[model samples]
Target: MELISSDKRNQLFERFAHDAFHLELRDDYSVPNEVGPFEDWLNGRESDDSFMAPWLQLMKRVTESGKTVRRVRVVTEPHSPYIQWEHATTNVNEEAGELIRWLPRHKLPAGLHFPVDGNDWWLFDDKLLAVGHFDDGGRVLGSEIIDAPEIVAECIRVRDLLWSIATPTNEYQL
Candidate 1:
């Protein structure tokens, strides 16, 4: 299957109406742009978050127009270092109008099965899906765009189920 580059997938942000939701199941993401920031955070040094500027700007625009961006992060606790950093920084995303929630992996309902081969995905308006593909080193490859009715429907169901139980970022404690 053909996969679109992350840049291309992000363009969906410009087109999607209503809501865009992301499911993050990984404890670490080795995004190249994040390498410096992550390392700085790990070393207890001040870190610059300018790398997130573009995405934050986009989310700000999207939410300002009445569209919503949300994410459910299924994490394993005690949180990984990266997750801890993410938890600390999530307020920035929220400030840009993205609603984020966290759910411990152990808290997922029994028998719940993730769709799209258990890969992370972004669902737009409950109609389109951009399923993330990653290399073995935890780096992103790209995303496969899937709009098949059955697949999108399954993702929507999962999004709803997880969203219902996940704790809003503000209420979650380390």
Candidate 2:
């Protein structure tokens, strides 16, 4: 299957109407842009979050236009360092208009199964999906675009189920 570059995948955000939802299933993410910030946090230094400016801006623009952007992060009970950092910074995301929730992996509904081979995905308007792909080391390798009705349907089902049970970031404790 062909995968589109992250830039191309982000372009979908512009075309999608109504809403966009992201399902995050990883304990840690090794995004290159986040390397420095993550390290700084680990070392007890003040980490700069300028890297997120663009994404924050995009989210602001989208939500201001009446579109909703949301995400459900399913994580292990003992959060990874990256996840801890993500949690601390989530308020900025919310301030920018994104709705983020956290779900402890153990709390997931019984018998819940992930679609698209258990990969992370972004569902746009309940119609399109940009499924994230990663390299051996967990760095992102772009995303595969899938719009098949059956697949999109399954993702939508999972999204609704997970969203219902996940705790909103503000209320979720470390």
Candidate 3:
């Protein structure tokens, strides 16, 4: 297994955002301040009322431009109303809800996909495969970057299966 440093993983994401399909799955959408930089970025904005404005704007542009940005949230402990509130305040929940409403969950066929247990993220771009590991502090430790076809195929399969079972943001009747 080849190991990739954190910096490399960030670069990969930067490039992947522009070049490849992206999917992210998290155990819970909400995280503590010390766990990720997203909350800090949101709180550090110049205006309190416009918190998450930039994120919302970007999401709007992405959706308007006709691109797919799929995300899955696995319900677990430590659920935070703050996170949901933020999404609602920014209109992100509404936007995501609308997008999901158009897509029938039953149309998603069974297949393999990646599994996100919170600390690791597996990515597949064509024939390349990367498995990133993070420290308890939420810093990427290293990644096993491989070009093996079998490994990439397996990761793809895992990703598909997970996607199939994920609850659609809009179609979630419960």
Candidate 4:
């Protein structure tokens, strides 16, 4: 397996933010120290509309493309307020209900998957894989933490199984 650098991983996320599909596994999305990059991306839209406009357009396109974007978050303790704010402010929860769906630990989508290990998050596209590890400070201790091919394959498999058992959030509400 190829080892991707932290800078490269950021670029990958930016790429994903633009066009590629994304999958994230975390305890919650709102850790201020942990979500710095994502927060930067979100805040950029407010300051430099031009910078995030294209990505926003791409997000709309992806949502309309009928391609499934999956995120599996292992909820533990109190949920992240930042994540809640993000979901609420961007209306990602409603939009995600419509476009993205949750996968249970026992099942997963056809081509995507990941385990719910604490702080171990993986982002997958057709060929590339990005992994990140955060310390208690919410600072990224390292993103190039996992490089073993077998580990990647295993994570993908685990994600698939979970997706199969997962339920869409909207379905449970009503």
Candidate 5:
């Protein structure tokens, strides 16, 4: 698998034609840029989300261009601290034009299987997938693209199903 730059992975958002969808399965993400923000949250500080400005800007630009951006996060009922922080800060994403939803693990239909390598991913335009790789400590290790029709199709199916069942951000509190 080839490791692609995070910038390139994010660049797909600008180039996609119809819709962009992301599936988040992890309980934690120890991204370097987020470390400080997470720490602030843990210390009872409000999330400024300044670090997310660039991506938020892109989301606004793309959505304003008539494209769609959505994400579904499958989280445990008693979410991890990271997820709590993410949930607390999700308004920023929504305000910037990304629609996010959450699904509790227990609410997921039994026997459901995720597509591809079973990691978190972004499926763009129903043609390409960018899957994230992580270490045991939850730090990101970049991502790679998959364009095979069978794999992409399965991912699309999984995405649609999860999105259908996820609770919209506004409908959820916590």
Candidate 6:
């Protein structure tokens, strides 16, 4: 698996031709950069949007270009503190124009098929995938790029299925 760096991921985003869809399966993420802000949030601090500004700017630029940015997160209900933190901060992304939805884990159909790898990923233009890699502690390592049509197709099918049933952020609450 070839790992792509964060800078390269930005390049992929800039170069994607159409929509970008993300599937987030993890309930918790131990992102080093988010430690301080996450702690602040836990202590009842709110973003003046500074911590999330770069990503908000990126999402704004993408959507203003007439492209779509969407995400479907499969969350475990009675949410993890990390997920609660994410949910609270999601408004930044929404304000920047990314569409997000949530699917409670138990709501998914039993015996449903999943991509063989079953890793969280960003599917760009329904073609290329930036498959995520994480350490045991849930810190991101990086992403591996995959452009296989068969795999991308599976991801798209999963995305379509989840999007159809997932609750829009406004209606979802822990």
Scored by Cα lDDT, where does model 6 land?
0.87
TM-score of each: 0.98, 0.98, 0.49, 0.52, 0.96, 0.95
Clashing pairs in 6: none
How accurate locally, in lDDT, is each candidate?
0.95, 0.94, 0.46, 0.47, 0.89, 0.87
Clashes of each: 0, 0, 12, 16, 0, 0
10 residues in a row with least lDDT, candidate 3 = 97-106
Kindly list the per-residue Cα lDDT of model 4 for residues 151-174, writing each as its tens digit.
666766665655556555555221
Worst 10 residues of 6 by lDDT: 46-55
State which candidate, 2 or 3, has the greater lDDT.
2
**Candidate 2: Cα lDDT at 171:** 95
Better of 3 and 5 by TM-score: 5
Runs off by more than 4 Å, candidate 1: none
Candidate 6 residue runs with Cα over 4 Å from true position: none
Model 4 RMSD, rounded to 1 decimal: 7.3
User: Which of the predicted structures, 1 or 5, would earn the higher lDDT when compared with the native?
Assistant: 1
- Candidates 1 and 6 compared by lDDT, better number: 1
Residue pairs whose backbone atoms clash in candidate 2: none
Superposed on all Cα atoms, the candidates' RMSDs to the truth, in angstroms, are: 0.7, 0.7, 7.0, 7.3, 1.0, 1.2
Residue-level lDDT tens digits of model 1 in 1-174: 899998999899999989999999999986889989989989999889899999999999999999999999999999999899999889889999999999999999999999999999999998999999998989888999999999999999999999999999989998
**lDDT tens readout by residue for model 2, 13-101:** 89999999999999988688999998998999989989999999999999999999999999998888889999998988999999999
TM-score of 3: 0.49
Record all residue pairs in model 1 with backbone atoms less than 3 Å apart, i.e. clashing: none
